[model samples]
Target: MYTLSLEVVNKCNLNCSYCYLGEKKNTSMSIDTAKKAIEIAVHEVQKQYDKTLVIYFIGGEPLIAFNVIYEIVAYTKSRCMEMNLKYMFSITTNGTLLTKKIIDFFIKDKFEIKLSLDGSQEVHDLNRKDYQNVGSFLTIINKLKLLRKYEKESDKKVSYAHVVTKNNYQHFEKNFQFLIDLGAERVETGIDYYCTWNNDEMKGLGIQIVNVFALYKNQVQIEKKRIYWNLLEHYLEMYLTTCNFYACKAGLNSMFVAVNGKIYTCIELPEFQIGSIMEGLNIQRIREIAYVEDKLSESCINCKYKSICKTRGCQASNYEIHRNIYEPVEVKCRMTKVFLNLIENNFTSQQLENLKIREDR
Candidate 1:
């Protein structure tokens, strides 16, 4: 309901280890295809949701089809203006192709760009590299520097996203500090959901990430508004205003449209292909996908700590041949419990007793 994310191209230059696209054939969306998606997206915005619409440029590498993106943005803006609609732009991109022109475009248009960066140079180079085995660290760092210079020249903020992995988990604070020094106005960090490792490996990686996070929390002196544990922060922010929560929103408000116009409930379900834009962009199809109840197979469904846990059953698990639904991984679950326990310990006795009494009643 908030954003309509679509892929214009599935042709990436870099071969990231954790990429969901994973050796998938590269494909680019034609301008006709782009127009179809735009028309459907704009129509849905005008006819359905009242909130401000945001068109998210998602891709194997959105910047690969930069001209298409520019065209879509210009066309959408003009149409929205004519229709008196409110809208904005967002894109998630690897920093490899973020040239000066792209940065200038983002700055001039105030488009939100979320560049993917792992923790540090060594950590990033390990997983995010070009086909020629070249490390992308220096190139991306240079691009980031350019972005910072833009901020100095124009006094506008640029956003950065850090994907936490076992390789760089130990350097969370250091990496974050580096970004801060780069003059990034906002930053968000999260676990790499597209990890190739199996359950145990993922669990180990989760623990490593948390270990690094604890170290970061203890060591860093973050004085400004930066997002740590992005998932939990977003959940808490939403819950503070509205008393609604969910362990998963696979089919709920969020929708992902792939480059071929196939729609999905979540990015994790990219292959599921729930519908297509060629069919008039039916919101009902999305609702059906979200509302269709699948059997909950997680071992920790009964765990009291499940409510606060950030890592749980993923989209891949649902589509797997065996459908392994494990409880929230131990690392995330334990960390959530630890944080919650700290909060409860700090509460006044009277307040704690009042909460208990309310629960009893």
Candidate 2:
């Protein structure tokens, strides 16, 4: 399975404080560029081992360029109609621009829509605000309600993603509950990786994550609530499977295409452009990005948590913080070990058996 991401527009309506794409530009992917990207993803590239591709649309906010997304999906569907491939559509949106028409389109396409909602109104508004410095939670909540209504009356699945920042680190359980209450069956979270995280914040965040895991366990094992927590499920899968999961899959099987046709391993590393749609992928640069030695570090190989830590990081993140793609971020490493320890030290034999049963089903 591979993913082809199109940064439909380098523009957004909201001016989020923690946005990685710091500056807003008027750039957008034209129909010609998008078609070229689609062709490169499906035809120009060889995919003998795969039969599925996730055609993902992202942006400062993708809905701002909905027409491009609409056209791209249609074109891709037509292009792949006869190929031995099945395609899926997904989008990450701020939820402010979702209209009945947009929602209908998503339903018709069966898009895996991930709505950006940071838990509660206060927490969400603290950083996720509009250009005028107003909170967007009020506007998005009504849309979320409408989405849940549609899901209840149909077979569509809507997921929620929230960022855990300094503003909401202490409210982990509450945040999860708030999203769950809003009918979010599948929820995911990301930490503000670029933001300052001192020892105190790190400690608090670790505790918050542990508590969140405990809450997930209670919900599933005791309360009989049905939900999906990305972290917990990932750990369970790691424990039960062949320990196959990537900390970051920046340049392998997945590639990010910008509005200007520049290709990079990940959106987080715009400066590390490895290729362009016009020139195809830079194999040498991609290999270098993955590291020349085919290894991250000697220390990582010898580390006790090698299985959990092998693919445990984004090269872009490493380069950003340490000026080296092969090096791992210290704080994030601590957090990953912490995340594993929570599952290992907390889950009982019976609970694990139950988890395996859930997975089997």
Candidate 3:
């Protein structure tokens, strides 16, 4: 799989506190740049014989440059058809600029849409606000409703991408349920590592995650509904199998292209830029960054749970917390251990005994 993340624009209508894109530069991708990016990405995909190519439109808000996206999608579809390549289009947006026309275009193109919704109106409005200091909750909710209406008419499912922060940790379950109530079938969230989480906040987050997991299990077992909790799904998958140290795809098969055509291994870690689309990718730099082992600390290497733990976590978060990609953030690692412990403690002796008995039979 090959992923090409195009930063369609660097300008946003709303300001989120923890956005990786620090400030709006009022810059958007020109058609020439967009065409060159697609051409280069397609060439690489063909050269590598990649089975699938994913063109992800990301930014301050991709819809801000809807025209550019329109052209790129049209061109990509045509080019991929000519080459007989498998490809898909996706976008991440704040959901404030969605319109019926935009929704129609997305449906026609079968684009996977991810809305940046934190949770309930109050929780989301606290950190995600517009330049005028106005909450965008109502506006986004209206757009979500419109999206839901259209989604029912199409095969594509609209999902929510949430960012969990200290302000919203306590209300995690409530916010999750709120999105579910708003017709979101898929809800994915990750911790905002930029925020300093104290001891109490970490415990609160652990409790919230356990509670949500229990609720999710009940929904699957009793209610028989398919609910996708992105964080829990990922951890559960890792818990049930051996952990791979270098799980991230950055600098390997994935690359982030900025609005100015600069390329980085990971979108969050812009400091380590590999190359530019115009100049072409630095394969040597990519190999050096991607193949470097020993991302774990000495203590982590000898930890009892090393085999099952995601020691590498997120490179971006590791860099943000420790100012070094190789050093694991102690706080984040502790939080992960707390969540894993909760998962381990939830299964009772009787439950384990029953599983053992079933396996023996």
Candidate 4:
């Protein structure tokens, strides 16, 4: 129950209007239905979990079925190495069919590519365009500047995701210092949850992302940081943040297997309905009671970040934008008090001792 997701193919080339697998969902699964949906999700996480299993590979563009994702990562690493288990893999690709034989099969089978660059290139070609309106942001920023000038996998690392909209929130710090000068060790950025960040164009992109972190307060460099403020860094580190449906273990830690073999709980909640690695990944027979009452709303039960938030904020964007799973809406709480009031006015004291020595290495 340490994560399992495999939407092997919902088939996407590009047409991002906040895709809810809708812009012609061509669906795909068969490679013997993705090896029997990874043998019923590794036999239901080895019959109710022990640990060490992390598979992600999600899509409408998981490299559009790159050979059924290289035969489900070589048969889920040869059946989780004959059941001694332990396999980790990740993918969220939109790096325009990254090639060099898909970056040498994501550097000899160890993938962690998250790429979905949403800034600059005129704010990511105005919302990742292409349905003949063309603009895959200069073909994914010239394939992330040709994978930072052909990085022949020196122990792989390439992360970048920029969403924050309202037309790129007044150049969100010159689009995150132009993807940290396009080398991008890490850069998440987020906030454009299908538009409307308390508009006036998102309070002018929340005062231009809090005045470019108060004008690069101490020449910005938070050591490759940016998990788009994962819920304001879990309310600034453990002031409370927990999930997996508040511990009922949302079908064990996390699972999303879509693209026709159907299974979901995260892929932004794929419109609530769950269950179907052909019909037995069974979260008590998911016919979808909005993820069986883990549901929230009344603006998340009168938000104060609802007991440290997480009820449902993305099940495939809650059925394509408020088709209703109670309507919580997200824009990262309209720029989390303007990026924590510009990190408490430029966090100095030698920039918090160089941000705690770059967050302790």
Which residue pairs collide in model 1, if any?
251-290
Candidate 4 overall Cα lDDT vs. reference? 0.65
Judged by lDDT against the true structure, how good is candidate 3? Answer: 0.79
Better of 1 and 2 by lDDT: 2
For model 3, how does the per-residue alpha-carbon lDDT over 1-361 read when each residue is reduced to its tens digit?
6788999999999988888778679899988888887777787777555557789999888999999999999999998898888898999989999999998888888889888999888999999999899988899887766787668767777879888887888888888878777777788887787778888888888888777777777776898777777776566555665566556757667778889988887764656588887888888887767666745677587766777776555566677678777677766677667666765787686764664465454
Residue 354 of model 1, lDDT score: 65
Sort by lDDT, best first: what order?
Answer: 3, 2, 4, 1
TM-score for each model:
0.78, 0.90, 0.90, 0.31
* Tens-digit per-residue lDDT, 1-361, candidate 4: 5667777777788888766566566777678877777777677667645646678887788887888888888998999899877777888888888877877777677777778887678778776876787878777766755575344553666778777666567777788778766766566666657655555776787777666554444344545343243333433332222443333244555667666676666654544545776676555544344354566765567655455344344344555577864465555544554554455555666755565565455
Model 3 residue runs over 4 Å out of place are 47-50, 268-271, 342-361
Query: TM-score of the candidate numbered 2?
Result: 0.90
lDDT of 1: 0.63
Alpha-carbon local distance difference test for all models:
0.63, 0.79, 0.79, 0.65
Winner of 1 and 4 under TM-score:
1
Reference-based lDDT, residue 315, model 2: 64
